[model samples]
Target: MRPFDPRLVRELPQTRAPVAALGLLGAAAGVAAIGQAFAIAWLVTALVGGGSLWAPAVTVATILAVRGILSATTEVTATWAGARVAGVLRERILGRWSRATADDRPAPERMLTISTHGASSVEPYVARYLPALVAAAVVPPLAIVTLLVVDWSSALIVVATVPLLPVFAALIGRHTQEATQRRWATQTRLAGHFLDVMRGLPTLVSYGRAEKQADQVAAVGDRHRIATVRTLKIAFLSSAALELLATISVAIVAVWTGMRLAWGNLDLQVALTAILLAPEAYWPIRRVGQEFHAAADGAEAIDALLADVPPACFAGRESMSVRDLSYRYPGANVDVLQGISYAVRPGLTVVTGPSGCGKTTLLELLAGLRTPTAGAAEVPRTHLVTQTPFVLPATVADNLALGTGASPAQIAAACAATGLDRVIAGLPDGTATLLGDNGFGLSAGQRARLGLTRAMLSDAAVVLLDEPTAHLDPASARQVRSVIRDLARTRPVVAVTHDPELAALADAQWPLTERVPA
Candidate 1:
């Protein structure tokens, strides 16, 4: 795993399109604003010089209408672009999650924060702040240059005070980033603790510790609330301070402009334009500061998730081999098995062991779910079947296909191999039977058999089974073992089981027991 950084949060499909559109929109908006300023100056001159007002009035109306249309178009485009970026980001996150290890899965609360609050927090910034930021950069400079041509003093005032907004924004941004990071950490912790407590509710109740656990949850919630309030306070203060600075700067520029007008150093039209445009210069900086705070939380969560993604290991030889392989759980002092070696030729081998003797762990090692802590293990291609099968919410045929795009006939053959053909025939929809929510409607045995069928459908060189028959009745268990035996005749099968009958049927068997290391 490498350190997480925001740069790695895959680029969105709409990134380039939105950026280009925003640039064009900003240019158009700047032009429109300058035209509006020029129109205002002309209208003022027309009224004062005792000329016809109708021309200036019509010009003002035209500029306003054009500006309005451009603004609306920019807004709509920004909204669509932001939504598309968000969708891309979500898909990338889920894709990375699927490739991550079991241990890499964030605590339930952290997952919720990322999926819900973190995602929502970034929306406005992407859609509104980004495009507005581009416009601000362009419009302010053009407006200030127009003022400079009319009166240098007003332009100087606007220029000198404008930099203060960004300076203040930088300082505030630093503080906000720190505060947001802390707030995000606390939020994830609170969520994780709540989920952990909920998951252990039965145990807590059994031991008469439910009240104690409730107090702990309350304490965690209180801490999270405090952190949230602190973050909000900092965010609000930063926004207010930036707004005040911009406002004061604009006011000072306006007052200076008014004095120049009174002294006849500048005309009324130029003074009015400068005053109207002063705030526009600082608007973008202030908006960016506000949006930075909103995006900070999501960035922090993404950082945490990305930091744990494991680096890809080199795929060497095509076939897998095992030599004196062993593993131990993290922080454990002893290996579960000692100096175990095996070669899985293209056929069935069953591993029989007592409870807590590392049968499932062995299957995981063979399936590439975990690497050996000592020695080496090799696998060409493999699929695994656990006691509790995971059934995705899809058609029965899809479940068997396992995203491999296997044909209907192939799926049927796999199902038949696992003795599920009769089960499918009995269903009203046959292969199209909907497996809802982890296959809840199906019995445990049915789910297990379906899982076995899916593994068969995978067409891997090796199939690893971890107690595939544990949930079945005697008749069904025997039938499944017979099917497995038949399949093993063609390709290698490595099964971990406690069933003596299954072990006896294996061409070769390995019994795992606690023993001294070699």
Candidate 2:
């Protein structure tokens, strides 16, 4: 992606209000800066000419106060805009990933980097670089235009040299683009490696290979440092070169003003204003160039994120619909669930099949979590209790709240219905116990009951269960089956279970078969 991608700017229409406000604040600050320049110039002229200095001093102080307020506002607004844009992008990225199949998503390590660290990098880009960009757009032109009106000769000198900064920076950038790309790739790989090694440290230690890999880790770390330093070196060199060019440009204007002032060809106040404004014109541009290099990674990351998340489509409102459904996994030779047609209403629909008949995939399709390869499916809002349901590290209330909103009584009722009331009651704080990681203290049966309880509490019209009874004993399974029976009374329920007891209660039973290759 281009370092200053306009699409990224476009992607942030939601952030336009704050960005626009920041720009306005920046423009106001620039105007105040110009006013300060004139005030200082007038003070110098008055002091030298033995005139009254009170008015110029007061003007200078007033401009300084306004500029200070503007600067603080710009900083706070920029910080807010940065955080808001990053959060918006992350939410969209995660939403897309959640709606997509695993095959469509980036690898875990890369996704984590983009969503966490990659998202964080945007803060500096938006806060520092964006504000600099606004200043560059506003201040330099304003300074040059003001200079043009005050002293055309100095303005001409300032204008002649400012373009050289960007041209020189671009030249340096072209020379280092390849090296920078390589550095970024290496940095990503090393970062992923560090995360991977740390996550697998226990496994490596168990195999007596943890210590041996320390050398590899150190080697990768050293390479990353070297590459990062090399990139920073290039960046610093470009900044220095731009600075030198800007300094020379300002000096040229200064020399012109100085000679004119010495020869008595220009007024003292005008000459001082020209000198003051010349540096402002050049430095804003140079600052932008410097910040662009610092913000390149975040810009590219945002571009990648925007590319990855396509526009969303709303789910249909049907209770259930399937016609000639077929699914062939990526690179597969044949469909897994081929030419299957089924429609279900608000009742118990038990689906039974041999181990490899794509029963779970069918449920996923109904839940709108996967698309059929060559069929039509319409399902309303759905809740799927997977074979291994998600159990988070949070309080029981928090975990249950992950489902549809319910009062304490409603939650307790759902728990009792799903045979989880006893587990909650036994906890130190009923419904408030913090399950460390994945309900760490809970048994498999308890997790199963919890999953079912949440599903029962969901407002979805369709609830798909994938082997929800697998982890339970006979008594618990019977209790859960009773809960499923009650859930079916309100909405459509399709459960994939090997338990004959659940199968017997089904109002309609679906027997699935694997698709055979032609």
Candidate 3:
């Protein structure tokens, strides 16, 4: 991996200013540090030569104070940069998923890991490693130039030794990067498995397979643990090796300067300054090496988050039309749908099929939530209500107004149309009532109505629903069916359902059959 990715600034322009600020601060700090070294050397020389010490003392004190303030500011800037970059990347990642077709996204669990854990890992990379990298770039060269001005022999020694740190760091970093990648993959797998177990816990328990799932989770956890330890081991070893190399390089410079001073070839002040500045040339590089290990996981996450995800393809048309549309899943050998043709019209169109006849997939395609493998679909702006509509934790009014920008009056009207207004009225806070995660405390019918109400608020030209009336009682089903029929009167409505009553209410019916072998 590169020490720093330029794409970070290109992809997230908001971070550019903060990153530039960091570079400036790092440069300023380097200047201050070098000044402190010179000031200390002057103070030592003044005391030894019986010269006035007040000026040198004050210079040392002032430079040290400036360095302290710069240190604090660097911390603050690094923190802000970390948060800003991580948050922006997370938002972009989620926004990409929101607009992409189903096939273009990663698995649910993998996406969950990326948006949360993966993006979060970038914080340390931005906060600590970046500043260290800047320091390594700005400080060492400045120190070497100063050394060259004072004593060319010392400067040559530093220049000769400085290259060794990065070369050794690169060799160790190769193994470190590999170890970190393995650990990251193992971590992703563990996170995916744990999420799967949680989602399927109820089913697993019912089938007496919960213990098996527990064992599987434990096994994955163990593998992740081992990978983590191995990565950390490499990180620790690399840090030690870099530190040892830096110490040895600095010691060599110090030894040469000491011999020059003893032989009366180098002045005492020059020797002291050389001793001080030699470490400056090596420590920043060491810091970068240490920070790189801490930021390795973040580097991997950045690569994944920036990977290309194809956008959904939908052509604008006057009306929705499917012409010989066919789709086969990514890895499937046979098509779930083939040679399907239809043009949606201004009425309810019920699509009926067996359990595995791609009925749900058909609605997804029409809604531009999936791309067809063969042929084309001309889809207009659409609102798709899946079998279990998404309901995040929020106020009733907020959930209803999500993405629609509907006013209070408009939201009330949409709720009334779907009979959700009654449900809202019975709540303690009415529209302001806060719902739990996944619309907890609301029944299936109520959640369904909430989804339909949202659809009612939308200005979509087409409405697609999956299993709208499934798992509802007779009274709730009647209310839902009435709302759906009322919606159909205004624009085109397509629903995938097994309900005979809903199918009977359709103005047209499209029945699908299982695909026969070619």
Candidate 4:
């Protein structure tokens, strides 16, 4: 997208308030700036024509002061508005991301970069570039007309060279965009690599290969640094070139004014006013060029993120159905389950399978985390309990409630159903005890029981359990099985297990085996 594209600006929702404020501020600033210019011209004319300068001096100072105040206020308001807009956009991006595919996550990091650094950098552009550009557009024409009234030759010189500034700015912008894209790509690759390394640091250290991996990280960082330097160099060069163009244009206008002054075609007051206004005409273009580069990084970041998560139509309230379901790992020759068929009713169902026989895959399929490549699987609302339960770093009660706003009675009922009543009773602070990371302070059986309790507390109609008793002792496992069997009386329970006690407790059992493709 073009750096100054209106569509890109419109994509940000927060731009509306600032744009409106900018229009008002621009008008005020333009009038003030032009008023100050006119006052100076009048004062010069008065002094040269042998008239009083008091009135012109007062007008110039008052207008200049008001312009400064407006400029500061506009900067503050525009910064606040831009921050709000960027925050809203970032939230929307994340909300959309929750539904994105695994492949879509990495690219969305670009959106984060834009929302943070890009949004912050663009504030100056809005407060300064936009208002200045407006002033440049309006004030110059008005100033030129005033100069024409005094002397047509100076006005002609001002109009002739003003267009050069924007032309040069556009040329510089084209080069900057390419350089920024390259730099952004390098940063994204580095982030992905760094995240991967952090996630696998434990394994790398255990294998005594952490030092080798550190070298790889350093190499990635070096490449990122080089790309960053290249981007900065291009930006610096472009700014310098644009600045030079504006300066040269102003100089040419100055020389013409000097010639006119020497000839008697222009008075001293008219000549000075025109010279002062000459740089003002190019100032907006120079500011625009600078702001464009700053905002370009954010624009590029948004583009990369949006590319990953293209607008998608959500399947609204559609019930899931599966039948004769089977799945095999990619590149694996054997099916995880052969001819597995089941209709899951709306209630608790325990799923049991032999070790490494696709039990977790089946639960993932049921929970809509994975799609089966073979057969049909039908499910409505689902909650899955794995052998090792995940307890977020939070209070025990919060973990059990899982944000459902379940009443104390309901929470206790769930605990009882998961055979956790005794466990909670034993705690010094029942339901409020802090479970550290991974519930490390709790025993394996306690964690498993808590996982089951959490799943039970959910409002989901169907619940799948994969070896819920895997970590429990024989007595605790028997108690859990009994509790589960009691739960199945009202809900469809599908438990996948090789445990004979659990199998006998289940209403039905379906054996799973790897099947070769025909």
Candidate 5:
């Protein structure tokens, strides 16, 4: 990982102010610390000489108070900035995912881990590491410079030994970065597995595989525990090594100063100030090493977040068309689809195929959800209604109003068109009633109609539906098909289905067959 990535400032201009503020705070704190060190040295010299103590004691107290205030302000600023940066990163990751093509995005599970846990992990890096880094940069040089003027011998010892801290840190940091990456990868997989298990819990229980899933979760959790312990062990060992080195270096300086003072060659005030300034130069560098190891996971996350992401784009053509389109899964050698071509205009075009024949894949390609391996798909902005469309645990009106931002009248009209108006009228609060997660209160058929209702309200140039009539009863199927017909009147409508009745309503039909390897 870089000490500080310039991309952080280049891509996220909002973070620049926070980072600048942190730098300023760190510099101020460093100045205060150096002043306090001198003040304490003066007070000690006065007491040892039997001189008046009141003036030097008051000066030390005032400097200490200033140092305390600086410390508190740095923490407050770091915390607020850290939270804001993490929030912005999450927003950026999720926002980019929303506009990215299916092929351009990671799987749902990986995306979940990165956008949630991974984004949150960056907080420590911003809050602790950055401030520590600024301190290391600002304080060590200031302390060394002060020592240079007062006692060049102590300054030489400090300058020589301070380099060792970073050298040791770098050696340890290489290992730490590798360990952190492994731990983070394991964390991502563990999170993904848990998320998958939770999402499929009902299915597992129904199939009597819940016990097996529980065992798998336990195995993964154990692995994660082991990985975490290993990472922490490395961090602790490295921290201890740094502490020992700094302590020994300071001891050497103290020994040298004591020898000179015993011979009556060194003055009391100079000897005391040299002792005070020695630790100042070492502690900030050591703290930087400590915070660096601690924030390794966050460093990895920043790399992932700032990686280049290409946005999904669709052609601005009036009609959706595909020419010799072909596609394959990421690892598979054989193509899922090949040598296919079709056009969708302002009328209903139905796609028919048997199971595993790439019907849904074709629609996804046309909607810019997936990129084709060969040929091109020239399509306009499209709204795709997948099987089991997304529903939130929110007011029915709010869910319907998603994406389209339809007015109340438009929503009512769309609901009436899809036969959802009757369902809403029977509810306690009608459109204002809250539904359960993933439409718990609604039947499969109602949910299907709800998706179609969204499509009806959408103003997208093309509408793609996957099995729109699959979950509906005969009456509901007919009603939904009528709405589909009406929608096709204004824009291109493509539906993937086996319903012969719905297929009969199509103006044109395209049949697909599974492609076999040559």
Candidate 6:
């Protein structure tokens, strides 16, 4: 976006090491290549004049072997650097959004693009484009300098023509940038549309609309194909033009060197070496042009991600307090939550509410997951058990111990307290059992209890539970309510539920209605 974004170095400090390594390796490799060009010329000259060739041949082989090793190293390091850079960028993005409210993050479709395929595309830019950039920087200057010392006539021709590569590339980009941007926008939308539709296909089928979208999908696919082909055609033509320019430039140098050789102004070795070194100056710049065309999408993605900077949050307190706070969604005319005052200390506070009255919003506010609109919240480190808790396709132990340093004994103790120990014991592998998303093979009650178990193991000063016993039977509900009581004895506990049994045991109960609020 900014040609070469300086913020990439400022923001992602981890990338500096690999990029510097590439630059250094490129310089070293360019030096070796220059030496190898002379060695190759000397070998050819020896063969032509019937001179002894062993020394020059060995020199050429050794330089080539060194270059080969450097090439392999460059390849591996570039790959590692690409994946590493992409990984760090993705981590920063996901971590930022994980701590942000719904108002701050992009839609799910765009977020999916940023975290997955978008991150994947950056690998090519780093592995290919960056190396080419280093080569274009190091090889061309070094080659031109070597040519100047060997013969200024060849150097002058190279210096004069190399500028045309970037100039031609710039002209091509200026002509196509608008179309490229439009096509890329359409490409992103089409891809996101297909993915979103696939994810919601079941819902669409239930609503009798799935079959209707097939023609739309086909139409979008065709449009994407046409746009992609057009973009590729421009890209290929631009690259071809640069290649042709480079070839003609190199030919000019070769013909000048040959003319000087025939006139006895230059020896065969210098003439041959000048021709070999001349091409290196042009190709690195040309390769850079090709890679830039290929990597523009990744560059744009990086720009998009870096522009979204997340804020820092500190732990406020180990209690819940909100005084006359009101919150509205961004760009909304009405408030999702009106002026409300609530406070909680070290005890059980049960909030009962009907649907869509900002119950979960209040809990999120208390957990420091969202900021207040017009007031302050003195909420502390909190462990919240949402109605639908996070479930990973990992072993049971991994799920329970996620984001906590709880040991096995502590995990088992918490599980026992929540009556989930029996569920884990009944499984074939106990705490090692593998689960699918949302805990497949486990009932909703078990999932809820597992979530409760995880919450119980948390070290947070406050615990927030959302319908912890919604899926459980009477007996299991009683067991969980007992665990809730046990949890309330030591720390501040906020439970959002409709169960009378749990409410009866609460130290406080606030109903969410027009007359009263929590």
Which candidate has the top score in TM-score? 3
RMSD of each: 3.7, 3.2, 1.3, 4.6, 1.7, 2.8
Give the winner by lDDT: 5 or 6.
Answer: 5
- Model 6's TM-score against the true structure: 0.92
Off by over 4 Å in 2: 1-13, 100-104, 172-227, 308-319, 354-356, 513-518
Model 6 regions more than 4 Å off: 2-4, 174-184, 187-201, 213-223, 514-518
Give lDDT tens digits, candidate 1, residues 148-189. 887788789888988887778778778877787777787788
Candidate 6 per-residue lDDT, tens place, 1-518, comes to 43466777788999899778877888888889889899999999999999999999999999999999999999999899889989988998988888876656777667876677678878887888888888888899999999999988899999999999989988887655656576657766777788888978999999999877877788887887888788788889999999999999999999998888899999898899999999999988899888876677678778766767455354567667788877776776767777788888677899987877778888877776677788777677788999988888999989998988998889878988988989988999988899997689688999999999888888888999998889999999999999999999999999988888899999998677532333
lDDT of each candidate versus the true structure: 0.76, 0.82, 0.90, 0.69, 0.89, 0.84
* Candidate 1 TM-score over all chains jointly: 0.87
Backbone collisions counted per model: 7, 0, 0, 19, 0, 0
lDDT of 3 at 79: 93
Selected candidate, larger TM-score, 3 vs 4: 3
Question: What is the C-alpha lDDT profile of model 4 across 93-134, one tens digit per residue?
Answer: 666665543323444445445555554544554545556556
Candidate with best lDDT: 3
Q: For residues 338-405, what per-residue lDDT tens digits would candidate 3 score against the true structure?
A: 99999888899999989999999999999888889999999888899988889979999889989899
* TM-score pick, better of 2 and 5: 5
- Per-residue accuracy of model 2 over 92-196 as CA lDDT, tens digit each: 788888877655676677787778877887888888887788888899899989998999988888788887877886677675665656666676777788778
Per-candidate TM-score against the hidden true structure: 0.87, 0.88, 0.98, 0.79, 0.96, 0.92
Model 4 misses residue 310 by how many Å?
Answer: 6.3
TM-score, ranked from best to worst:
3, 5, 6, 2, 1, 4
TM-score of 2: 0.88
Better candidate number, 1 or 5, judged by lDDT: 5
The TM-score measured for candidate 3 stands at: 0.98
